[model samples]
Target: MKICCILCDRYFTPDKMQIKKLRKHPHRIILCPECHERIAERVRKRKKLQSLKRHPEG
Candidate 1:
Protein backbone atom coordinates (compact mmCIF):
# COMPACT_ATOMS: atom_id res chain seq x y z
CA MET A 1 0.00 0.00 0.00
CA LYS A 2 1.16 3.52 -0.78
CA ILE A 3 1.12 5.83 2.23
CA CYS A 4 1.48 9.58 2.18
CA CYS A 5 3.60 11.33 4.76
CA ILE A 6 1.46 13.31 7.13
CA LEU A 7 4.05 16.07 7.44
CA CYS A 8 5.19 16.56 3.84
CA ASP A 9 2.35 14.90 1.98
CA ARG A 10 4.88 12.90 -0.02
CA TYR A 11 3.43 9.63 -1.29
CA PHE A 12 5.61 6.58 -0.90
CA THR A 13 5.42 2.83 -0.68
CA PRO A 14 6.44 1.63 2.74
CA ASP A 15 8.58 -1.43 3.32
CA LYS A 16 7.09 -4.78 4.20
CA MET A 17 7.68 -4.31 7.92
CA GLN A 18 6.05 -0.90 7.97
CA ILE A 19 3.07 -2.22 6.00
CA LYS A 20 2.58 -4.91 8.63
CA LYS A 21 2.84 -2.40 11.43
CA LEU A 22 0.34 -0.12 9.74
CA ARG A 23 -2.09 -2.96 9.31
CA LYS A 24 -1.72 -3.90 12.98
CA HIS A 25 -2.11 -0.29 14.10
CA PRO A 26 -4.31 1.48 11.61
CA HIS A 27 -4.43 4.57 13.80
CA ARG A 28 -0.68 4.98 13.50
CA ILE A 29 0.54 7.12 10.61
CA ILE A 30 3.77 6.96 8.68
CA LEU A 31 6.30 9.77 8.54
CA CYS A 32 8.82 10.07 5.77
CA PRO A 33 12.47 10.02 6.86
CA GLU A 34 13.18 13.54 5.63
CA CYS A 35 10.21 15.04 7.42
CA HIS A 36 10.99 13.07 10.55
CA GLU A 37 14.55 14.34 10.58
CA ARG A 38 13.44 17.90 9.89
CA ILE A 39 10.89 17.79 12.69
CA ALA A 40 13.41 16.33 15.13
CA GLU A 41 15.94 19.03 14.24
CA ARG A 42 13.39 21.78 14.71
CA VAL A 43 12.26 20.39 18.08
CA ARG A 44 15.87 20.14 19.25
CA LYS A 45 16.57 23.71 18.27
CA ARG A 46 13.42 24.94 19.94
CA LYS A 47 14.23 23.07 23.15
CA LYS A 48 17.74 24.52 23.19
CA LEU A 49 16.39 28.04 22.77
CA GLN A 50 13.86 27.49 25.52
CA SER A 51 16.52 26.18 27.86
CA LEU A 52 18.69 29.20 27.19
CA LYS A 53 15.80 31.54 27.89
CA ARG A 54 15.01 29.72 31.14
CA HIS A 55 18.64 29.81 32.35
CA PRO A 56 20.52 32.72 30.87
CA GLU A 57 23.62 32.36 33.03
CA GLY A 58 26.32 32.15 30.36
Candidate 2:
Protein backbone atom coordinates (compact mmCIF):
# COMPACT_ATOMS: atom_id res chain seq x y z
CA MET A 1 0.00 0.00 0.00
CA LYS A 2 1.13 3.55 -0.78
CA ILE A 3 1.19 5.75 2.28
CA CYS A 4 1.92 9.48 2.24
CA CYS A 5 4.11 11.06 4.89
CA ILE A 6 2.35 13.86 6.71
CA LEU A 7 5.57 15.85 7.18
CA CYS A 8 7.30 15.46 3.80
CA ASP A 9 4.19 14.69 1.82
CA ARG A 10 6.09 11.95 0.01
CA TYR A 11 4.53 8.66 -0.97
CA PHE A 12 6.17 5.50 0.36
CA THR A 13 5.34 1.84 0.67
CA PRO A 14 5.27 0.74 4.28
CA ASP A 15 5.55 -2.82 5.58
CA LYS A 16 2.60 -5.03 6.47
CA MET A 17 2.81 -4.19 10.18
CA GLN A 18 2.80 -0.47 9.51
CA ILE A 19 -0.11 -0.82 7.15
CA LYS A 20 -1.96 -2.76 9.82
CA LYS A 21 -1.36 -0.03 12.37
CA LEU A 22 -2.51 2.68 9.95
CA ARG A 23 -5.58 0.69 9.14
CA LYS A 24 -6.30 0.20 12.83
CA HIS A 25 -5.71 3.86 13.72
CA PRO A 26 -6.65 6.10 10.84
CA HIS A 27 -5.90 9.26 12.80
CA ARG A 28 -2.24 8.41 13.29
CA ILE A 29 0.37 10.53 11.49
CA ILE A 30 2.43 8.70 8.93
CA LEU A 31 6.04 9.55 8.18
CA CYS A 32 8.64 8.18 5.81
CA PRO A 33 11.69 6.42 7.24
CA GLU A 34 14.01 9.38 6.57
CA CYS A 35 11.64 11.91 8.11
CA HIS A 36 10.99 9.58 11.06
CA GLU A 37 14.71 9.20 11.75
CA ARG A 38 15.28 12.93 11.39
CA ILE A 39 12.47 13.75 13.81
CA ALA A 40 13.66 11.13 16.30
CA GLU A 41 17.20 12.47 16.17
CA ARG A 42 15.95 16.01 16.75
CA VAL A 43 13.98 14.83 19.78
CA ARG A 44 17.03 13.05 21.18
CA LYS A 45 19.18 16.14 20.70
CA ARG A 46 16.56 18.35 22.33
CA LYS A 47 16.34 16.02 25.31
CA LYS A 48 20.12 16.00 25.68
CA LEU A 49 20.24 19.80 25.54
CA GLN A 50 17.51 20.03 28.17
CA SER A 51 19.41 17.65 30.46
CA LEU A 52 22.61 19.66 30.09
CA LYS A 53 20.74 22.86 30.87
CA ARG A 54 19.24 21.28 33.98
CA HIS A 55 22.59 19.89 35.25
CA PRO A 56 25.82 21.57 34.17
CA GLU A 57 29.26 20.14 34.97
CA GLY A 58 32.60 21.84 35.51
Q: What is the C-alpha lDDT of each candidate?
A: 0.90, 0.93
Best-fitting candidate, scored by TM-score? 2
Q: Tens-digit lDDT track for model 1 on 21-57?
A: 9999999988987887899999999999999999999
- What does the lDDT read for residue 40 in candidate 1? 95
| Error of model 1, residue 48, in angstroms | 0.3
Clashes of 2: 0
TM-score of every candidate:
0.69, 0.86
Show the lowest summed lDDT stretch of 10 residues, model 2: 14-23
> What TM-score should be assigned to candidate 2?
0.86
> Candidate 1 regions off by >4 Å?
13-20
